[model samples]
Target: MRHEHEPKQRKHTVRNVILTVILVLLVSVGAYAARKYYNIKHAVDNTYQSAGIKKNRNANAVIQAKSPISILIMGTDTGALGRSYKGRTDTMMLITLNPKKDKTTITSIPRDTGVTIPGYESESPSKINAAYAFGSSGTAIKTVQEMLNVPIDFYAVMNMGGMEKVVNAVGGVTITPTLSFSYDGYTFTKGQSAKMNGKKALAYSRMRYSDPDGDYGRQTRQREVIMAIMSKAGSISSLLNKDFLDSVSSQMKTDLTFSDLSAIAQNYLGARKSVSQTHLQGTGQTVNGQSMELMAKSELQRVTNLNRKNLGLDHATTGNIALSVSDASSSSDSSVQSANVNAGN
Candidate 1:
């Protein structure tokens, strides 16, 4: 039941922080749920989605053998938050978990980064996020693997909207902003700590234009809230909410089985250490008329090397990757019709 004092926010309109929230909270919370295994298992089971791609390394074997592995965490702004159509992914993070070393890395891939969606239109570069729309998780995984030259062993996709409910379910989150700004009817000042409910948290994270670093600054605030929620979500009362569990499960689809989560809780507790994040930078260009972010080959190679090192794979330089356009004058953007890229970088 919602608090009568709380004002109602938009019905299905939260952002993608829930992707990381669900990915971690589900596993760590379950680790403490020895008394509620069946219930937790049932909820996780409701989120089963098979990737069906042949892996270079088997996920189960790697986990059972206590080896390192990588996962792609994706969140689509679709099927909820008033987005009824099949939507593209706005949030994509390449995650590597090393249980042997107690370290984890999250590399953010911009939604508008230009890449060829393998099976979709195989002709030219489209934003990396469109890979999900062209084909679901499978194509997205294939595109990321081909471009970055990394093996994705597991993945999870969720409607970004559940974040609001998640925040409220944890009795709301507290945050301190580094800058003061107003967006969507809420305001916060730099260096001031205040408790934020779901709606305010969403507004706080979604404001990028006012930030000095734009989207990267937005990501930092998102991380702050994610850490806040992760810290608060460990309580039994928070995870045992039947209504929250049902709603979250219905919105998520993942290749991780309940057993996989259980194994993670058992063998990979070390991965719960402080997360290190890297952002793959991209420059905007008119790609076939649409504004797309293009990453340089050197940057891709840098990201690839880190992911490979974390996964214990032999380092190999990335090739066949999309390179950024340098000559801006060559773009016939005014002449060519742009592709629909409603989601911005």
Candidate 2:
């Protein structure tokens, strides 16, 4: 009877050990899965093609290398319900990332600002936003380059739906109202801190009719949302979530490569924190029976000076190139004049 009892006790001990080992293995697997999920979640595909813009092969020659890279952040009204890819960019901002100074300058160009397209000649003075519809991203880049007299290094295009998804992914962003205004069935009170989700944030940035500053005020709100999004994105929680990355990538298109993103993530993450906002000073005028924002030559020169100085580019005079206009006979520039400047995070 004693021998039989001993055998049973040994058997029970053995069973306990086996169960413990299995539990440990399961825990290890879970940890690994979590790590992998985080890595992949923050990892985004490089969608930027370096074709039209000037390429700097020596961009990453050394640590703390000061390379001035310009990116076009485009927000399109495409991919929304009942919308298609043929939509033009509704918001565009030129972001100059200066890694050396750990500083960034964002220049907001009102979409209604008239500009000449580089390759086209039929239109002498056309709305700035028309460049995207006429020639896609490439043409838009060229048009901006001509308009601003600056080099564009990359382009990131985000659909309207993607903007909402990004806002939702970060939970939400807080925006301070500049003035009390209502449009698109939404009302924003002055001097209030509004917690905005994707839809409401979209409405917040899109409402321009009731704004006292008009497009400029709307653009300021857009920049506010952008800065809010960037702040949320920089958090460790966002960097570790794979679901958020997949959502953002699916909703947006870009020319930034994966390696470029990683380098930016590792090297220029500080620059995002130190950003200065810029707006082109312009006035509204009726051109060809349509209201347009006309940027004065002095205003353009000021933006060019600011962008060039921020990027550490060769300090050249802003009036070297002739302004080229896009062909307006094919498409009305008024349809494309909806571009506004917002945040680029």
Candidate 3:
């Protein structure tokens, strides 16, 4: 009986020790998370504002409310060349997040899309991308609002140079090149799947002229790299890497508070699983010696309706005024744009 009792006592002691170790680990992890949150919040505070524009109606809103939101992601050329913050916006994407439907829609606006920037007072309509070159990101945000008739809830600006740092930090990303091209001594074969580091990804996104579909092809590649980054950044290993975290803090600027980001990550990140990507449509032509992508007013209205519908906003506000435009004449551009709209995760 004593031998049997001794064995039972030893088993109970081992079980208790294991449970104690697990509880210690859980407590340590919780403490580490709290410290990390505080440090990040401190680092992200006091970023630049959009100068002189009204932010979306989410001033008093919380992510827990689960309302639809729109964010503008702009790739600025300033940081690459060590210039001032005033630089041309080469890439712009509008993202609509709908928590109710668990879907995200990302729409790319062509850099050359012709539109009149409000308060710009130019002699004639200029390329939409020039809004940033003329008046910084504030002007760009206001111009996008005026053109699309959609409220932008948030805006994030990333320097082109930062792309390389971010990609390299993630140990590179895998992408399939749609068109074969060489730029800056880097060669990309058509329809080839390859892992790309910072330099290659930058070249991949910057080679517009070499692409059969031109700027539209560039947009598709940009979106692909972005999605790959998102995938990598979602991993615990990537998130825990000090270099990656430092790169993100140094390279990206946004209007989102740390609390806002945390809440979105907690509640709305799942919507990314059903993302739909699309690009604004237009016909490229030269007007007054200036090249432009003239988007039909009808096309703009169509995109506006799509975004509004996804945001759970009332559709009655978008009128059918611009209804008499023709289809895009660039077949390659249209095909690339169409294929990306339903790109799967």
Candidate 4:
């Protein structure tokens, strides 16, 4: 009777162990399947399709020399439906990521800055914001490329509707206001550091009339909000959630492919540490009976040099683009910078 009881106990223990192993395997497979399913679904839905974007199949060729890459970051006011021909870029930031120095520079163009439209020669000088309405991202990218004489490698365009979602997704953001100003029924006091949500964050950035520096003040706030977003983005927790990824996919329109984005995420994480904020210096004036912000020839050369130097390009070898601008500047004091042309503020 003792021997029989021992045999039964052994059989029961073996059976339980086998069942536990099976359960573990099943759980592991299920999790993998779920992850794969979500990845496929999101990829299909958010696959970027844009004309101006080009992929370097040989990633080695693109980054061998530690050259700087330029990305045009446009925050559109497209609401929930996403970007279209009719949409406008409410926020425009030109970001240059220098791999050699591991530095980044952000130049914010005012929405009200004046420029000449490429195709619409008859339209006279117009506000920079009107370029999108006149043409698509290709036009916008081209306009900026011409203005700055920098190659725009990629673009990440997102709607303002996602601003709130992004802030909430990241928990929240802390911002230090330089001056107190109220707009759109929101009140912010000077020297106050406030925790901002999405709507409040939008309000914080959009209030310009009350600011002493006009659009420059507003642009500064916008940069602050962007920095806050970047800070939240850096906290690894933000990237772990499937829900957050899906929401971001829905909100952003980009020319960046998944592989390109992955490489950028890996290689350029350190670039954010060296962010420099630059503003274009120009006097507000009217050109040909149209309101414009006229940037000096010297200022244009300075910007061009900064961009070229950041890109690790030998100024003499990087095509005659720089020289062309330099030559154009010699004849006319008011001759507009090509890179500044058609760039909406």
TM per candidate: 0.83, 0.72, 0.76, 0.71
Q: Write the per-residue lDDT of candidate 4 for residues 1-345, one digit (tens) a residue.
A: 011123433333322221111111111222334445455346424836574534322333454434577767666664563434446676676767786688766666666555555564444255565566566566667666666666677666666667677677777789889898887678898888999988888789877778988877775576577567656655333443555555566676666555455455456545644555555566666443334555555655566666667767556222221122223233232334332343332
Enumerate residue pairs that collide in model 1.
12-81
Alpha-carbon lDDT, every model:
0.70, 0.59, 0.62, 0.56
Alpha-carbon RMSD to native, per candidate: 7.7, 17.8, 15.0, 17.1
Cα lDDT tens digits, model 1, 114-154, are 77667754334677877776667888899899888999988
User: Which residue window of length 10 is worst by lDDT in model 3?
Assistant: 18-27
* Model 2 lDDT-worst window of ten: 18-27
Candidate 3 — which pairs collide?
none
Query: Candidate 2 on 1-345: residue-level lDDT in tens?
Result: 011123433333322221111111111222335555434424344233443544333333422353667777776765642244346666787877777787767676777776656665454355666666666678888777777778777776666556677789889988888788776677889899989999888888777677777776666566566667766765445544666655556666566655455556556545644556666666666554445566656667888888888778767556422222222224354332332111100
Q: Output the number of the lDDT-best candidate.
A: 1
Off by over 4 Å in 2: 1-34, 37-43, 46-66, 80-85, 172-176, 191-195, 227-234, 272-274, 319-345
Error of 1 at 28 (Å): 4.8
Model 4 worst lDDT run, 10 consecutive residues: 18-27
Task: State residue 250's C-alpha deviation in candidate 4, in Å.
Answer: 2.1
The candidate maximizing TM-score is 1
Model 1 TM-score, all chains together: 0.83
